[model samples]
Target: MSFFVSDRAPANRVSGYKRRIVLYCLGALLLLLVAVAMGAAIGETAIPLDVIGKTVANRIFGAGYTLDPIEEGIVWSYRISRAIVAASCGAALAVSGAVLQSLLRNPLADPYLLGLSAGASTGAVLVTVIGIGGGMVSLSVGAFWGAALAFGLVALLAKAAGGGVSAQGTGQIILAGIAGSQLFNALTSFIITRSANAEQARGIMFWLLGNLSGVRWDDVWLAVPVAVGGVAVCIWHMRALDAFAFGADSAASLGIPVRRVQVVLIAITALMTAVMVSLVGSIGFVGLVIPHAARFLVGVRHGRLLPVTALTGAVFLVIADIVSRTAIPGQVVPIGVITALVGAPGFALILIRGRRMR
Candidate 1:
């Protein structure tokens, strides 16, 4: 009688795949840690990396590292908070961009493609310059309501224009987003001009350009959860998002419940974008450029694309924030300025390569 032997090659392959994924995850986490440390160490005060580490350790785990109070305060209270917020903001925007680009079937789709950022700006200006909230509602609260209003208007217009979740519907949504953005931007400008106060204009315009200087631990609490939750929600719909590549009809044919998936994901995107914009102002390019870069690196598979895109966006924005702080001798530039400088060229390259492939 021959002894039966079991084949374990398939098991080995499965184990190998799991090991590879773990390696990728570990590598990404290490990179993020290094980037965050750099963000804390290389700022205006130039804290040492060891001090940054000790501060973090002392704060998180009570390591008792006996660091200087000033250094610890700077790292723990200021730089670390800003860096983490940058990471959170970047991840949220990038995930939103990927979702919008997939759902809308538009290469240029971004978080602000729904007019959320513009409406948030309008709302913040109304509260700040026009005093619509009468010193009661905060800037973030006004921005959220404004974003909700703009989304409602855009939804109605898109529904009227195309009537269903079809190919035409995506196009109408884009057009509606553009129209809503223009309207809200005009409103923001009108309110600012009515105020006619250069100081307020200067301050709010700087914030509108994208400012992270005001970020703190409280902002971190708001930002990190939204980014993590947004990514988790997107990952849950990875299969549906992949099916969406062939258009709504194809997605529906694949049992995707196209309309429901679209609505849920779009709402998630809007919520993530509104929260981040309210926290950090409207920084561009993280959402628009990072997804294309991830797609280029990982191909078009959403399962692999979403997490990688979020990590890349987080690292890129942390670096951008660093640049914004140190790009000049004694002045901090708006984070948007740095992102635009990098993203414009990056997007041009993506378009050129895409055309060549076509």
Candidate 2:
């Protein structure tokens, strides 16, 4: 009689894989720090490297240092806020992208394609063109609602199509998102065409393209909480996200209660995405493209994939923002434009490769 024994080799292989992933993540994190420092140092005013060093040190440690008031003001106020927004928006978009891709089981999935960004842009454009908000904060709130409405509509449509959240055939949901995006985009164009104010028109136009300028500290407060909460929600559902890799039925067989978990997961992602898009306008490509890149690096396991994607995204955007500001001295290019230029080609390549595979 032969006794069956459990194999330990597979477990060891898994352990080795995890170790390599950890080491890669550490290296990525260090690169992210370098990217951030470069972003902070090389902006419009060109803050000295020493000044950048000192300001960061001051913020990181409670250490005392001296600098000219003008230099201190520039580093602490203008440059830092923009850089922080850059990183925050990057991480938020990246993680949101990862969540959306996993939810839909499609690499092409992104926040804007799902209509969240366009919807939010429409709401905020109305405010910008009509001068609805007496204050900046109120306008952000308007954008948030618009974004939330778009998200809701998509969710409703997905449920109607027999895949409320857990259904793995994402073709229907993706089509719905595209339709929703077009609807909102047309509405936004209508608003812009009817507007009487040129300044408002320009502002609305710029916002739609996406930018990191005109950002103040108050915007950070709004963006940070939503992003953090979204990340937390995603982390909690990492296992569920992993289950999605094999499609919904496989997940349900594994006792994941696919439908219920999916609705909650999508809802959380939509909320977080709306807030970020509303704050920064429709920054495209980062959410869609970054996750695919991360997957290539770390595979599709959401446990490791999510955080790595987030960090890579943050690094990408920070570098993008730096280029936007400094690429031409007088013109502050919109951050969204930069991301699109970088992300669109990669997306097209992914689509082509996916088609070939099919």
Candidate 3:
């Protein structure tokens, strides 16, 4: 009886762990819905949650419900688009963060740390200020190219520094990323200062600080596929990610293609970051903070971590966007500002607690 009890205890513990993960995921989904509803309902002119539901239903399923033109425009055009973009961007950034932390073996690693955002900013600034792409190429295209370029340079520098995406090379990669970020950021500033007029520079500055007010269905469509695809790729590589947690040598011994997996995951993260940055500018800290919070809630296994991270990120950004719009009457704060204000303190707390644990 005692021997059977030991086996049963282990099985019971495993079951309990799985049950908790499922419960957390379910809770996250519910919170995401509530966040979306709250985002739609809390603007200058409030629309009830019921109206938001009806509006969405009517638009999607031809339900027999209606609203005034202004209300319809607010719900369908402005708020919904903003909410969707926020959710998508949040999820993309957070997942990128989670992957990077595992891939780099550094909990502090985030998407922007690799200079993607800076490169994207430089691209957008060039397009807006100097019209480098002429009228044919769009800002989004410029940003994507910028992000790709930045990633290439970072990888090059990291390789040159003797790390080259191996587990032992994480520190070199971080250093390269820092150098690239500074260089690109300076280039962005130079472009804005030298080429953009006062008014144009102001607009670029606003965009760089992260504005979601102008997001539309077009932006949402551009973001959703990239976000979904990147996340799916991450999930497919979950076992590889778990292996990497024990270091590249461990992963290799486990028959993982360490170098190839690292490159692929990094590329996926860069693509996700590029699309989101192009759509919403550089909204920081969602990547840095959300993944950490999700990891705390769901543990480190990518199987549980990724989905919960995505859901938490979406809900967090939606709520953040809502606060950005409503925090100051008659003026919308930049979403980046709000995130920084919230994330900086939370991150510091994480660092403090992490140090204490040591």
Best first by lDDT, ranked: 1, 3, 2
Residue pairs that clash (backbone atoms under 3 angstroms), model 2: none
Q: State the lDDT of candidate 3 residue by residue for 1-358, as single tens digits.
A: 9999998998999999999878876887788778878888888788988889988998899997957768877998999888988998999999999999999988889999899999999998888888986777788888889998999999899999998777677888999999999999999988887888999998888889898988898998888899889999999999999999998899999999988898899889989999999888999999898888887677899998999888888888999999999899999999999999999999998888767978
List lDDT for all candidates, in order: 0.90, 0.79, 0.90
Task: Write one digit per residue (lDDT tens) for candidate 1, span 6-46.
Answer: 46667788999999999999999999999889899987779
TM-score for candidate 1, please give it. Answer: 0.96
Cα-lDDT of candidate 3: 0.90
Model 2, CA-based lDDT: 0.79
Steric clashes per prediction: 0, 0, 0
Model 2 Cα shift for residue 234 (angstroms): 1.7
* Candidates arranged by TM-score, highest first: 1, 3, 2
The digit string of per-residue lDDT tens for model 2 on 276-332 reads 777777788888899988887888888888888888888898899888888888898
Could you tell me every candidate's TM-score relative to the true structure?
A: 0.96, 0.86, 0.92
Q: What is residue 88's positional error in candidate 1, in angstroms?
A: 0.8
RMSD of 3: 2.9
Candidate 3 Cα errors over 4 Å, as ranges: 1-27
Location of the lowest summed lDDT over 10 successive residues in candidate 1:
1-10
